[model samples]
Target chain A: MLEVRNLSVSYRHTWAVERVSFVLQPGQVAGLLGSNGAGKSSLIKAILGLIPCASGAIYWKNKPVTKQLNKVAYVSQRSQIDWDYPVTVEKVAMMGRISSTGWFRSHSKHSHLLVRQALERVGMWQYRASQIRELSGGQQQRVFLARAIAQDAELFLFDEPFNNVDSQTESIIFDIFAELKAQQKALLVISHDLSETLENYDKLLLLNKKLIAAGSIETVLTNENINKAYNRYLPVGNSDQRGFPSLPLLTNQKTPELQKSTRC
Target chain B: MLTWLTEPLEFEFMRQAIAIGLSLGILSAVVGSYLILQQMGMMSGVISHAVLPGISIAFFLEINVAIGAFIAGILSALLVVNIQKRSRIKVDAAMALTLTSFLALGVILITSLNTDRINLDEILFGDILGVTSSDVWRTVIITAIILILTKLFYKELEFYTFDPLGAKACGLPVNLLYFGLICAITLTIVASMQTVGVLLVMSLLVGPAIAAYLLVKELDRMMLVGSIIGAVSSIAGMYGSYYFDLPSGAAIVMIIFGFFLLAFLFSPTQGILTAPELKNKVFYWLRSLLN
Candidate 1:
């Protein structure tokens, strides 16, 4: 299990995230949804200790998250990576074993096996020798997914893994997410997607610089929560009328209920 | 051709100079592969020039000049990091500020102290033929240590440089690794200062690595190929200097640039004139302009 208590991240005197609190239980896939500049990435970075938290704490397995970082796996936004870096797909996957292999020592046979399995699982084994820059966007995402799988960590945090990925890659990702969930690992995924893909996550956490709602998908994606988080007036609605709760139309636009509502 | 090479070996100073050049060539290229990959190639220029103040101070204190250069190089890098971290200023601006300040201070100290023994021209453009045997040995030792450490920490360094956030998430000590890299770069500069001097050392560091980068698909191979290029360029440059009466450091830099130009135009995979993609683009642009 992973827990965050009163977490706040500020940059130079301005607050990017303010007193947000949430808990992610094992065997659960929680989707973090918010509009642009909503502090979603900031919250994730703070949790990983990539950025300092203004006032809060993160705990994993009843210990400080910072103390047990080896148990956490993070895939940053694809835009953050240097795609032109000179590395093969297999080498990138093998990087997951660096911490485990330790300093001044070569990777063990088991580590290599794990890396191979990860590449095969992601259907990138054939392209193992290819340079990373040669792969398409979807293939690149799969390669990073392979890296995360090779890490073999208890907690996984993905930032916008679905961005720029093809539909096939999307299904592959959800399938792997299901497998990780079945193994009782905790997962938190930050995404801007609000399609039927919401069905893949067990829970949803709505945010706009603060925690707007946190609960089951139906409970968290309510009309009021969407209005509050997105600052757009959504018509009042119940889960039964919409089949499943979806954010209402903002401004002069017609509500999603009036149009063809996307169903899972 | 063999006599041309063998004749220079007759002189003890010439022999020492060749040994030092070869060692520095390999060391600079290996260390420089990381610098260019990180897109901090200019950081080498910053650190190299930053060593001036340290050398002047060391001369005043009667201590090892290399030690002073190393310390000053590391401090300047740290200063750049701190400046970027503490403010909204970007890294390039911070580097520029630190590079100039240290260089200016070095000049002031050198002139104010009246260090007649210190040669400004030699420091700017190295006197490779004047190197002693001890200098040769020092360059060799630094080369060996750097190579061994690079081998030992290859995986960790690769991960850290490629994706710092991912590496940090996996519990790698990224700060320690970064500091180690900076130290390696500083030591490389110190070693090359006697061969190429401060001004032209950037070519020795970045030239071969970039040339290899154009043709290679992986970091290890890039480093290996870069080392070969560095060694050849160093020896060829030395020979050119011996026969053509050109400055030794300038000759080496020119040779390295010559190799870079060859790779740029002829590399099978990424060559401007040779690669299909680039060739078509160039032709298209030319046709459009003409029509």
Candidate 2:
């Protein structure tokens, strides 16, 4: 289990993420949804201790997890990596074991076996000797997924992984996430798309600079909540009524309700 | 051909120079492979020029110039990092800024001190012919140290260089690795100051490594091939200097440049001249235009 309390991240003088707090239970698949520049990456970075959190604390299994990076597996966006770096797919996957293998030592045969297994799981075993840049966008994501799979960490944090991937890759990743969840590993995934794919997550945390709402998919993803988070009049009604219920507009809440009642 | 090579080694200075050049070549190419992979090839240029201030300060204090140059090189690298952190200036710009300013400070200090003890030209261009047996020994020691460290920490260094964030997330001491890399680069620059001189050192550091990059897939192989290429360039350059009376450092750089050109055009896998894709594209374009 991971606990984040009153998490805040600031850049220069202004706050990018302000007073956000949430508890992620073990064996749960949580999704962090936000718009562009909505501090999603910043929040993930803060939780991972990649960037300093201005306020609040992060605890793992009731112990301080910040700076204890070895316990976590972080798969950054593929765009963050230099695809042109001179390395083979197998070599890239082998890096996941470098930390566990320790200093002044080469990777063990067991580590190599894990790397091969991870690559095969991601359907990338055939391209083990291929340069990383030669892989397609989805294939590159799979290679990165293979690296993460090889890590075998307790907590997995994926940031915007669905971008530029095919349906097959997407399904493969979701299956891994489900498998990790079944094994009771905590997972936090971030996505920008607002589609039915959000249904895969057991819980959702909506954000637009702050924690707009966080709860089970049914309660937190209400149309009213999304409108408030997206700050747009999305005209989303309840899922029972119009697929997903719309949030009451803060600007003219009384009018929409009155119109609904009159129509009823 | 044996005498052609054996004739030069008969002179003690020539033997020392060849040994120094060979070691320096291997060291620079191996280390330079890291630089090329990191895409910080120009960093060597920055360090080589930045050491001038340290040399000048060392001359003023009557200390070993190599020590001073090493200190100055490390200091300038730190300055670049500091400037990049505190301001909007990116790394390349910060490097360029430090390169010129540090070099200028060194020039001013040397000129103002009016010391006849040190000549700036010798520091910038080097005096390979003037290298003593002691210089050859020092190069050997530094080369061995670098080679041993690289072999010992190969996994960690490769991880840190390829994907620093991933390494950091894995709890590897990435910052320490980065600092160690800087120190290695400084030591290599200092060790190399005698043969290539500070100014021409970049050719040794980057030229051979880049050439080898075209032919290899792995960092280990790149380092090996780059070392061989660099050693040949340096020794041949030394021979060229002896027979043709050219400046040793300049001849070495010219030879390395020639190797780079050869690799660029003829490397089997990726070379422009050897790859069929370029020919196919040219023919296809001509056919389309004619149609």
Candidate 3:
């Protein structure tokens, strides 16, 4: 279980996120929902201690998270990674075990086995030897998912994982989360795809710079609450929106020719 | 060339120079690979040049240049790191301030000096052909020690460079690793100044790593390739300089630049300069349009 109370993050003088608070119980899948620049990434970074917290405290399993972080694992946005890096998919997955072995120790056969199993689980075993840059956007996300699977941590933090991934890969990854949930591992996912999160996550934390609503999906994702959090005077047009916007959908402005490829 | 290789061992200076160049190439390439990956190219340049003022001060006091250079490099690196920590100043600004100001200070100090005990030219452009045996031994010892450190802490360095946040999360002492990297880079720059000159130290620092990136797809392999290319370039540049009456440092830089240009033209993955049909067609169209 992870608990954050009054968590805040500031970039210089600007308060990017303020007085944000949320909790994820063991065996529960929690979704962090927000629009662009709404502090979803900031909150995630604060939870992982990547960025300094301005105020308040975070606790993992009742213990302070300031010093103890071995229980947590992070799968950042795919864009954060350098795809042209001279690394293979397998090598990237092995990085997950680095937290456990403490750099000096050689990667044991057990670690290699775990990496292979994670790749197989994600159906990325075939591309294990392929260079990272050669993989498609969805494939790159899968490779990262494989790394997270190798981490085998109790708490998983994913930031915008389904950005460029296909539904098939996304479903497979969500299935892994479901399995982890069955095993009582706590999962916190930051995703813009609301319908998918509504279907998969047990609880939702609607946020825009601060906590808008935190509870089960039914209680938090209401039209009124979303509008208030999103800071828009008008409604979002549809109560039960079928499909959330994908990255490719946004790229329609760049080249109108690419819109047809994104429809499927 | 084959006969010279066999006979070159007889001459002690040749042996010493070879050992110095080989070790320096190997160590610098190993570290340079990581530096390139971190996008800290400018940081390395800053640390390298900033050491010059430290050397000048050390020279005035008749102290060891290595000690002075290390101190100066570390302090400059710390300043850059701290400024990045506190201020909203971009890293480029910090690097520019530290490197240029220190270099200018070194130049002013050199101008103020009256003693013939230290010639500014020697420090600025290097004296590879005039390297003392003792300097060669010192270079060898330092290079070996650095190589050992790299091997011993390869995993830590890799993790820190690839993902500082993750390394910090794992309680891996990210700051210590960062400090260690700065020290290693400082040592390389100091040792290499004797051969490549302080002004052109970037050739050894960036050349081999960029070359290796062109040829390989794994970081480890890239390091190996970079080390080999650096060694080969240094030796070829030294010999070419010997034969053609060219400046040794500039020759080395030119060789590296030539290889970089060649790689740019021929590299399969990212070479903008090397694609065959695209280059010809683009140039032809450009010529026609201009006409």
Q: What TM-score would chain A of each candidate receive against the reference chain A?
A: 0.89, 0.88, 0.88
Best-performing candidate as measured by lDDT: 1
Regions of candidate 3 where Cα sits further than 4 Å from its true position: A236-264, B4-10, B111-116, B268-291
> In candidate 2 chain A, what residue range of length 10 has the lowest lDDT sum?
A255-264
| Model 3, position B112: C-alpha lDDT score | 75
Model 1 per-residue lDDT tens digits across residues A1-264: 899999999999989899999999999999998877789899999999998999998999889998888788898888889998999999999987777777888889999999999999999999999999999988998999998889888999998888777789989999999999999999999877666677899999998899999998888877788888877754553232432333432122222332221110
The per-residue C-alpha lDDT of model 3 at residue B64 equals: 87
Regions of candidate 2 where Cα sits further than 4 Å from its true position:
A237-264, B279-291
Best-to-worst order by lDDT is 1, 2, 3
lDDT of 1 at B262: 97
DockQ in order: 0.77, 0.55, 0.53
lDDT of each: 0.88, 0.84, 0.78
Which pairs of residues collide in candidate 3?
B265-B273, B265-B274
DockQ, prediction 1: 0.77
* Residue A127, model 1, lDDT: 99
Give the CAPRI class of candidate 1.
Answer: medium
By TM-score, the candidates rank as 1, 2, 3
